[model samples]
Target: MAVAPTPPGRRERNKQAKLDRITAAASELFAEHGVDDVTTQQIADAADIGTGTLFLYARTKGELLLLVQNAHYASALERGRTAAAGTTGALDGLLALLSPVVECNRVQVDNGRTYLREMVFGDPTEPHHAEALSIVAQTERAIADLLSERTRLGGEEAAAMAGVVSAVMFLNLAPSATADASVPEILATMRAQLAAILPG
Candidate 1:
C-alpha cells in the first residue's frame, strides 16, 4: 500500500494559506496596475485579511513590496545559481548569475526603487527583509563557489571577493534600475564594472 504523505499541521497550513493569499493578491495588483497604484487596504481586502492583520505581515507599503517580491527574488537567485554551475569562466558565470537580478529590478522598475532604497535601512529582523537578505546571501555564495572552482584563491579570499562583486553589482544597478537604460546596456555596464575589479 502506498503510504499517504503526512499533512501539514493546522497552524502551518493556516499560515501557508494566508501567505499564499497575500502573495497572490499582491503580485496580481502589483503586476496589473503597478505598486505605486496599489493600496494596503486593497491588498488586505483582496487577500481576505483584516487591515490590522495585513500590518502584522508587513508594516508598510515598502515592506509589503519586499514580502510580495521575496519569492521572485529567491527564484532569480536559483536561476542565477544554475547559470553559474554550467560555466568554468569566472566572469561569465558571475555575469550569468547576476543578470537575472538586474532584470528583476528592471521589471519592477519604480517599485524596485522603493524596495532597494528601503533595503539599505530596513530592519533585518523583519521576515520579508530577512528573506531578501537570504536571497542575496545565496547569490554571494554562488559567486564564491564559482570563484573557488575556477580560481586558486583561498576560501576567505573567494568569499570576500564575492561580497565585493555583489555590492558593486547592486550599486551599479541601483541608478540603472530606474533609468531609461535598456537591459543590454545595463548588463554591459555591469560587465565593464566587474571587469575593472577582477584580479588580472
Candidate 2:
C-alpha cells in the first residue's frame, strides 16, 4: 500500500500561477510585436507582476522568449509526430513530421528567428534555454525513430541522419538571406534537400 502523491501546497500553487501569467503575457506580447520590439517591463506589466518578479523567472529578454517559445515548439513537435504516424512514404512521412514545426516557426518570422538565435546562443545554465534545447533533442529523436522505421537504417545511422535533417530544418527556418520566404517556399527547399539525402 503506497501513499498517494502530495498535491502542490499554497506557495507552490502561487508560484505556478505567477509563472503562468508571465508566460501568457510574454507569448502575447512577442506574437504581437516580435521579440526584438518587446521589452521585459512590458511583459511584467502585462502579467501584472513587478519587474523584479519577471527577472526571477527570466534574466534576459532572450531567456523570456525561450520560456515562451518552448511551449509552442513542443506542441508543434507533437502535432508533427501525430501527422507522421499516418504518413506512408519516407519523404512524405519526413515532411509530415516537419511541417507543423515550420508553420510554428514562420507564424511570426522575426520572433521565430530570434527564438532560434537564443536557443543556439543563450546561456545553457538558464532553465528556459535548457528547455528549448530539450525540445530540439525531442524533435531529433522523433525524426530518428521515423527514419529508422522507414529506411531500415541502424539506430546510430538513423540518429546521425536525423541530426542532419534537424540542421536543414533550422537553417531553413532561420535563414538570414531568405527571411522573407513563405512557408511553402521553405518547405519546398527542405523537400529538395531531404530528397537528395534520403534513400530513394
Candidate 3:
C-alpha cells in the first residue's frame, strides 16, 4: 500500500484561491476590454482583493498579463501539438502546429502582441515571465521534433531550423506590420516562408 500525499495547509490553500481569483478576474477583463484599457484597480475590485494584494501576485500589469496569457498560450500549444501529431507532410505538420497559436494570438490582437513583448522584455526573474519563456522553449522543442521526423534534419540542425521557424511565427504574429492581418492571412504568410526554407 502507498501513502497519499499531504493536503495543502490553510495558508497554501488560501494563496491558491487568491491566485485563481486574480487569474479569472484578469482573464475576463482583458478579454472584454483588452489589457490596455483594463486597470489593476479594476482587476482587484473584480477579484475582491486589494490593489496591494494584487501586486503581491504580479508586480506590474505586464506581469499580470503574462500570468493570464501564459495559460491561454499553453492551451493553444497543446492543441497545436495534437494537430501536428496527426499531420503528414512537413509543411502541413508545421502549419498544424502553428495554426491554433496564431488563432489564439489574434483573439485580441493587441493583448497577444503585448504578451509577446512582455515575454521578450520583461524581468526574467519574475515567475510569470519565466513560465512564458519555458512555454516558448517547449514550442521550439516540439517544432524540432516535428522537423526531425518529417525531414532529413536532426539534432542541432533540426533545433536551429526550429528556432528559425519560431522566429517566423513570432514575426507574423506580433509585428506592427501584421497587426491588421487576419489569422488566416498571417498563417498564409508563415506557410510561404516555411515552404521556402524547409527541405522538401
Best by TM-score: 3
lDDT score, candidate 2: 0.93
The TM-scores of all predictions, comma-separated, are 0.89, 0.97, 0.98
Candidate ordering by TM-score (highest first): 3, 2, 1
Residue by residue across 106-187, what tens digits does model 1's lDDT show?
7867776667776777988888888888887888888888888877767999999999998887776677443777678878
Candidate 2 per-residue lDDT over residues 1-200, each given as its tens digit: 99999999999999999999999999999999988889889999999999999999999999998898888899999999999999998889999999999999988999999999998889999999999999999999999999989997899999999999999999998878879999899999999999999975
Error of 3 at 35 (Å): 0.6
- C-alpha local distance difference test of each model: 0.82, 0.93, 0.95
Model 3 C-alpha lDDT per residue in residues 159-197, reported as the tens digit of each score: 999999999999888789999999889999999999999
* After superposition, candidate 1 runs with Cα above 4 Å error: 1-6, 176-178
Where does candidate 2 stray beyond 4 Å? none
Candidate 2 residue 110 Cα shift, in angstroms, is 0.7
Give the CA lDDT, 0 to 100, for residue 183 in model 1. 70
Q: List the residue pairs that clash in candidate 3.
A: none
